[model samples]
Target: MSKSNRNLFFSLYWLFFLVGISTVLVGQVLPILARRFSISDSESGYFFIAHFAGSLSGIFLYNYQAQKSNFIRTILLGICASATGILLLNADSQVICTIGFFLNGICAGANIPAVNMLVAKLSSLRVSSSLQVLNFFWGVGAISSQPFFHALSSDGSVLLPTVLLAGAYLIAFVFIYSHRLEEKTEESSRVNRASFWTVWRNPIAWITALFNFAHVGLESGIGGWLTTYSERFAKEGLISATPVFFVFFVLGRAIAPAIIDFFDDNSFIFLSLLVLLVGLVVIVFSSSYVGLICGAGICGIGTSAIFPANMARFAKIFYPDASKHATPIFVMGSFGGAITTYSIGYLSDYFNSLKVGIFVLFANTLILIALQMLVLLGLQFPKKDKT
Candidate 1:
């Protein structure tokens, strides 16, 4: 990469880190807020939906305004919104906090696709490596949040950490805006007329979307509720279980990049799904907390590479003109994560068992595995012989 491109890539990487930290902070704080507000577990999940709704709105808004302007501007706007959201979270008013979180989610949703597109443009030849590096920083950010939140803890209020997250987003905004790339009209118009549904109509896109849906559903469902599962299995309170969950999740995400280089993307995904299956079974049947923790770690390891691997695979499979297609795939995947994470909470309420809700994640994993197999089989079949 040229010096300019290298700088751009690293800058975006830091932005990814900031976003990751923000996400983890939100995840950690939501449950605390739930307890404070005296809401049910399922109700707590609505906070995630509120966040997703914001993100969905941001996507559409960006799609409209971004065509006539530069994406960097959109990213900066997102950062500002996210920062405001984080700060609002510290307010005493519950209504303000909810609105803040909604804005934060929207900002985050818009920022991610714009950043990913920037990275794609910068490192056209090594998209996978670039994305993996970005994701690695994201893991680092999540890891940092655990200790940061721990240090910020005080007399029953999560305000300090929320302030810290707001500061982080502000820093991200500065970096992104300062290094903003000049927009090229050629690239901007490349897919200006293409609708999201237009991209979704491709057979490969649908297959990948479904695979992403299951992949994200399984991953987010587990991550969102893993602490609750830990509380049940370890008999600890929410705060105590979270650090363990964060450690496991961070370790798995951190290791994914190195591991991907060694295995074919499809093979890596297939193996990960299989590992997830075993881990889920272990969690289901395990007799003690230790067993459950072990299972959770295994599941994390299994899921660690799914996002990056599938993302890279999708870029390759749909390449030569992937930007139009890849953006929607990512959007759909994000939507899937939101849906699955929220669904798990609702299902947990219905079943009255966090364990059962988690087991349902295993079934989603099975569906992912099946879809991937079909893709693999399709690849294996010989091309039709023309007379």
Candidate 2:
């Protein structure tokens, strides 16, 4: 790779790392915020809604604007927005904090797709392996957040860490923005890619969207609520159990490249989904602390490779048209995450048990497994895409 591309890769990885922290931060502190605002579980669900709704809006906005511009500008602007959102979290009002999460979602919606597309372009030949490695950095940031939040929030206030994190985002923004990296003429614009309507017509598109909806929602629901769930039944503190989940999550992604080398993308994802199912089942039924921790770790491992692997498949399956299709897929994912996360909260409130709420995800995982099968079958009978 050229020096410029290498630098671009570094910047993109850092951005992914920051995004990982930001995305997980809300979930990590949701319980504290609920107590602070005196909100019920269902009411607290709005935080997820606000963030996800903002994410959907950001995806649409980025897609519309990206057609006329390059990615670097959108990325830098998204990072700035992320920093602003983090700072907003330090506010005393629940309404302001909700808005803060909403803004953070928008930042994620914009940045995730943009960065993924850029990295795909840069590593055309090694898309799967490269993406797996790139996402491993994301896992690193995610795993770090558990202890980071735990240590920083010892006084039962997350304000200090949020402030420090926001500052870090600002520093990253200046550093990435000042770094000169140019897009290739052909890659600079989205004009050559398939239109949204064109990509929308394909069966594979719907399959991809559905899988994203369920899978993203399941992952978010689990990650967002696991801490609270564990707190009720397990002997550990609020943050202790959550780290085990992310540790295996990080480990799974870290080793995915080698795993994919031994298995095809579809096969690897299939096995991973099965593992995820086992993990979810363990969490839903287990009463012991050890079982809960083991289940969380299994879940982390199960979810680790699905997203990046699916993305790599999407790009390969659609090839020349993949870039344009990403926005819709990601938008669906954001929607899924928002609805699913909120649904878990709402269900928990209704049933008066977090375990019952988690059953929602368990059911959704079954649906996701079916969707993966369809994707696998679709791959065997590849059709000429009319778009």
Candidate 3:
């Protein structure tokens, strides 16, 4: 990569790192949030709903915004929006925090896909590998947020963490906005300009989005609920376990750049689903703390490859039209996370056990695996040499 591309890479990577934190932030803090807000499980579901709704809207809005603004300005706008959300998130008022979350949603909806588009367009590496690198940073951010905050404030000082995260975005915004981006290729620009309805109307695009939906549901559902599950069913140090799960997640994605060399992307996804199923089984049945942690860690590794690999495949298969597919897939991912986050809360409350909610990850895994098969079958499950 040239200096400019490298700059874009680091900037985009860090943006996602914060995004990962925001994505998992709710679940990590749910225990504290419940106490601080005097919130019930049903009401808690709204938090996920609000954030994902913002994210979904942001994805489409970004599709629109990308036309008028350059990437740097789009990113700066997203960071500013996100920063506002974080600051409000720290406010003492419930009403303020509620608006904060909606703003956070808009921030995520706008930022995640927008930064990602820059990374995809700017990568010096293979698109598959570059995306893996991006998401690996995301896992790093996701895993680190819980423990970092827990270390900073065990009593649920939401302000400190939110402020810190918001600061990161602001700093990143400065770095990216100042860098001069290379002119976009005409082909890339044309593809990016594809009508939203055109992509929405395609079966492949819907199928692609569903894969992301199920994948995000599993990733967010597992990441969000694991600590709570461990707290209720296993032990008290669930906060510490957050990083342990993501260590394996990062490990999986770190190695994903090379996995493409050994197997087709869809084949890797198929195997990953099996791995995830095993991890889910371990999590569901494991009666001991050690067993639970180990299972959760395995689950992380299983999920690590899904988002990036699927995304790379989408871009590759669709080729020039890849730009059109980006927004909805991102929206579906946010939707998946929202629904899964809500489902876990609802199921856990209904059963009066976190374990029941944990089981939802298993169901999502199955759905994602089925989607992977559809992709494979649609493409006739390409041969080894073909990969």
Give the winner by TM-score. 2
Comparison by lDDT, 1 against 3, better one: 3
Higher-TM-score candidate of 2 and 3: 2
Q: What is the alpha-carbon lDDT of model 1 when measured against the actual structure?
A: 0.69
Q: What TM-score should be assigned to candidate 3?
A: 0.90
Q: Across residues 253-353, which tens digit of lDDT does each residue of candidate 1 receive? A: 67766566676777777887888788888778998777776777777667766777676666665554454445455456668767877777788899887
What C-alpha lDDT values do all the predictions have? 0.69, 0.80, 0.75
Worst 10 residues of 2 by lDDT: 378-387
The candidate scoring highest on lDDT is 2
Cα-based lDDT at residue 110, candidate 2:
86
What is the Å distance of residue 333 in model 2 from its true position? 0.4
lDDT of 3 at 182: 53
Off by over 4 Å in 1: 65-69, 185-201, 237-259, 380-387
Higher-lDDT candidate of 2 and 3: 2
Writing each residue's lDDT as its tens digit, candidate 2 over 21-65 gives 887777888878887888888998899998888788778767764
Which is superior by lDDT, 1 or 2?
2
Model 3: CA > 4 A from native:
67-69, 180-202, 381-387
Candidate 1 contains a number of clashing pairs equal to: 2
> What is the full ranking by lDDT, best candidate first?
2, 3, 1
